[model samples]
Target: MIQITRTIAIDEGELDESFVRSAGPGGQNVNKLSTAVQLRFDVRNSPSLPEGVRSRLERLAGRRLTRDGVIVILAQRFRTQERNREDARERLIALIREAAVPQAPRVVTRTPFSEKRKRRDEKARRSKTKSLRTGPIHHD
Candidate 1:
């Protein structure tokens, strides 16, 4: 079981991993060995996650989430399958942990009166300066 938080624990069976060949840094070994790990988790059907976390995870997963509600994580940073697997699992955990945290409510704030006045004054000053740059108005 993967413990995401004090309240959330996902079963090991929830995760599915597949190995594939990785590109970059491994040289000849990269061509021969399947070092990349593709980890998949079904967000829609997971019994472990809270509904809020599930929604947040779906948003966070973005393009990684399939139409069927599976999150696909590809890990190829390491040159060994074990390392890639670990990396994938760690990434999943991190993502889930992030989703578990509640977002802080945004406070609606108005512009300060002094700041607004200062901006207006600056704009007025700029307009006056630009107006002065023009030649004196002439009446026909």
Candidate 2:
């Protein structure tokens, strides 16, 4: 099981891994070896995630989330399959951990009276400064 948090643990079976040839530094070996790791996790159907977390994960997955609600993460930074696999898993874990955290509700606040007054005062001061720059005003 992959422990995402103190309360969330996902089974290893939930993850599907596929290897494909990665286009990066590896000399001639890059052409022959499938070092890239593609990790898939079905967030919508997974029993491991709570409803809130599942929704958040789906949002966080962005373009990586497929039409079927599978999150596909590609890890090709490393040249070896083992390293790439680990990278993919670590990324998944991080993503899950991020989703697991509950977002705090934004507290709506009104602008302080003092602040509004201060802004108005500044605007008036600027207007005065500009007014003084002009020639003596007549009965125009």
Candidate 3:
């Protein structure tokens, strides 16, 4: 079980890991060994997450989430499979933890009366200055 928060724990069986050959630093070993870890978690089908958290997780996952709602995390920063696996797990936990936190409601604020007045005054002043740039009107 992976504990995401005091209330949220995900079963280890829920995570699916696949290994692939990584593209850097290992030289000849890179060609032979599969060091990259691709971690997939089904956000839509998970029983561990609350509805709100699941929605937020899907939104946060963005491009990482597949059409069927599986989140794929690729961890290839490390050259070893163990380190990459750990990195992938850590990233999943971090993402879930972030989704668990409730977002503060945005407070809609109106423009202050003084600020509105100042803007109107500035516009009037600009209009007056531009008006003065024109030559005097002549009547035929």
lDDT of each: 0.94, 0.94, 0.96
**Candidate 3 residue pairs in clash (backbone atoms < 3 Å):** none
Q: Could you tell me the lDDT of residue 112 within candidate 2?
A: 100
Q: Provide the TM-score for each candidate, comma-separated.
A: 0.91, 0.92, 0.93
Question: Residue by residue across 1-140, what tens digits does model 3's lDDT show?
Answer: 99999999999999999999998567788999999999999999999999999999999998999999999999999889999999999999999999999899999999999999999999999999999999989999
Judged by whole-model lDDT over C-alpha atoms, candidate 2 comes out at 0.94
Looking at model 2, residue 98 earns an lDDT score of 93
Cα lDDT tens digits, model 1, 12-44, are 999999998898469899989999999999999
Name the runs in model 3 displaced over 4 angstroms: 136-140
Stretch of 10 with least lDDT, candidate 2:
131-140
Inter-residue clash pairs, candidate 1:
none
Q: Choose 1 or 2, whichever is better by TM-score.
A: 2
Q: What are the runs in model 2 whose C-alpha is more than 4 Å off?
A: 136-140
The TM-score, computed over Cα atoms with residue i paired to residue i, of candidate 3 is 0.93
Report the candidate with higher TM-score, 1 versus 3: 3
Evaluated against the true structure, the overall lDDT of model 1 is 0.94
Error of 3 at 71 (Å): 0.1
